[model samples]
Target: MAEALPRRPPPPTIYRSAAGEAAIRALYDKALAALPYEHAERLVETSFGTAHVLVCGPADAPPGEPDQDAELDPAKHEYGKWALEVLRGLGLVPPANADGGKGTAPPPLHMGTSFGAAVVLDLANVAPEAIRGAALVAPGGLSAVNPWAFALRLMLPAVLYRLLPCSLTAWLSLVSVCDEPAAEELEVVLMGWKHIVRYPPLPGGPSGVFLPDQLSRLTAPTIIICGEHDIWPCKATAAAAAALPDCKTIIIPGAKHFPAKQHLIQAADWILDWFAVKGLVPAATK
Candidate 1:
């Protein structure tokens, strides 16, 4: 995350006209327009009435398919595949892929991919009563991101980011955890390359699909966010939260899948306030 980044090769902002999509866009714009220049922050934090632990997970709770990455991209075939396999070796499946791929390879044991994060995921589904509040925005689980979007994430290496395309520069700068393109095997890639000439995964082969049930079990005060331009599962994610005991769905306008950057301030305000509402932090915290 430290190297110089590639400047985004500006592409004309293409407009799409779906109601939900429009809402997301308008919301992102409106949210960013509201950020005061002074307090804008890259990091978002909030404490709920409950012990606020911001745990990140894939959209669904199951491990993504042996290969499925909730976020996928066309140019990222190599990186995605690599990450998927490595993560699979560890066992932190992206919550969408329950059973590995279609074949009978023995499912991997628990993912030991250890990143020093304090948020204990097992607690996410079951918050203690004292932990009266919770807020979620695109956790760590897997979901199929647009192919182009996924490629944008892979354009740079971990420490060397300047390689990112200029137009996608901001996206590369945005916060994301890149995983592999799930479900596809070498045969699929070889076939596409041979026949289609340039067939990067349109939608991947057989990785795990996002399931609503993974979220249907949550029982905490929750806030969910979606980005306007976020094409995949934006509405579906919000809908999944509907069954939660307490939940609110928010759409960030104008922003795409990664609304955290566009609406970071607004998001911080909402998350903190949700915590404040439940009296988790001192009234003076805000």
Candidate 2:
């Protein structure tokens, strides 16, 4: 008989101590408690694999697309598409003919941050009417990032510690991406990076996924929130934003890639304002 194949190793846990684990869990509990509406967690099966997603907002609220985060999954975009269908299956999305069963209205709004922002852009391009509006935070689709923003200083060391050093690489990359204010959350961000790089869904490398030329194909109202310092490819991101027919770009002064997370209230305000301006949010929400 043929030898049995080796089992794949389980992923690493972020916390090294029980106290740390309890603390993190407490933080999560607090966050969940703060949500305006009830939420559910489930495993969404996709062609790639099972994607764990948190569904929140009113149970009767209109269903929307999934917002991609900065996780390095090569199939991130594909997962977003699949997530839309899953939301529909869960009845989180309202019926298409909810208007007294008259006719189909616009789909629900979708949003994302950082790499997720890039995924939202790609989704808009792929399915113009799949969503109503798109909101991004420190999105990465802009092709014009400065070459120096790549954290080349840590490249050699990254290769040297290639066997196991995501935390170090993540720290180096964070240093390159953030400004002074981001220092307060540097440790949190470091742990986040460690989690991301530990068993990265996708290999680390440039996917060349975002194409500025394709921005024109998007018909949905799109917004981009970026940090002035996180400006990769120099002035290219601004230029690309300007090219989009219905795009609005906002640059946070003295901020970096993780501005939305660091400045949650500000980011939330910006998002609500954008939705109101686009007539996506209700008057009460304003």
Candidate 3:
């Protein structure tokens, strides 16, 4: 008999069912409705692809203060560069200095969480003068981890997600969240577990950590926040903050890799307070 070829694994996708996508959309809409500030959706063309951006806050507010989401591709730095270019083209952010010369124009502040935070750090390393400041929450790329162990840990949860009831799986996953998850949060988790085929791995196996020299080049003021119980990057984050020329570090109590909603709000307040102290933003009225 002729030799048979090995079967190829199917490609990864965000969701497995239309129902799951709808549930996610409903949750997003609910969150949007509850926002204290208004937001507008915009599509900006970039060299790589069209950028879908959400502009929040008042219409009269200053532009170029971009908030990056965790959904960005962290495996490469091109996406971050592309986003900056898009903002520059829109006149939201100042262009880079010419011929590697430093410009006197003020730069925009950036805030990012998880993989998005990694992107922010990469940008700061490559173009330090382009960023005024940064707020990184549970940032990645601070340390190296054993890929085998990481893969095994992820596989355990995925296997349980497939074998056990979704509620049970979600409850187990809650160990990473400090507070009881809201109904919407639970629903989102359940839907994700039920639908997602494969999860993407971090950029490097045991080599994602940025060199100390690279971090030393980040001259902008920065604040890094990590959950007290976040085993993945808590220590690494602190070490990174210590290495930076100007940096602040905060650890939220009783929080894990995924902090509670209230903790997130607290972190935001801290960032804003820090910015105010630095005169980057106006102080909140009591």
Which candidate number has the best TM-score?
A: 3
Ranking, lDDT, top scorer first = 3, 2, 1
> lDDT tens string, model 2, 1-286?
5233233233355455666666656655666686776677665443333455676677666533343222334444543454444444444444334442445445767787765666656656545556678787776666645555553633543453455555555456556555543443455554443333343332112553455556676667777777777745424677777767787878777776655455656777777787888888864443
Residues 231-273, candidate 3: write the lDDT tens digits. Answer: 4557667876677888888988777766877888899899998
- Pick by lDDT: 2 or 3, better one: 3
Could you give candidate 1's per-residue lDDT for residues 43-127 as a string of tens digits?
2111111111122244333232122222333232322333333333333333224544565333221221111000111223222
List runs of model 1 lying over 4 Å from the truth: 1-122, 126-131, 140-144, 147-213, 260-262, 282-286
Candidate 3's displacement at residue 60, Å, is: 3.3
Residue 140 lDDT in candidate 3: 73
- Give me the overall lDDT of model 3: 0.65
RMSD of each: 18.6, 7.9, 8.4
Output the better candidate (1/2) by TM-score.
2
Better of 2 and 3 by TM-score: 3
Rank the models by TM-score, top first: 3, 2, 1
Cα-based TM-score, every candidate: 0.37, 0.65, 0.76
Which stretches of candidate 2 lie above 4 Å from their native place? 1-38, 62-105, 152-175, 179-209, 231-234, 260-263, 284-286
Error of 1 at 164 (Å): 11
C-alpha lDDT of all candidate models, in order: 0.38, 0.57, 0.65
Q: What TM value does model 1 have?
A: 0.37
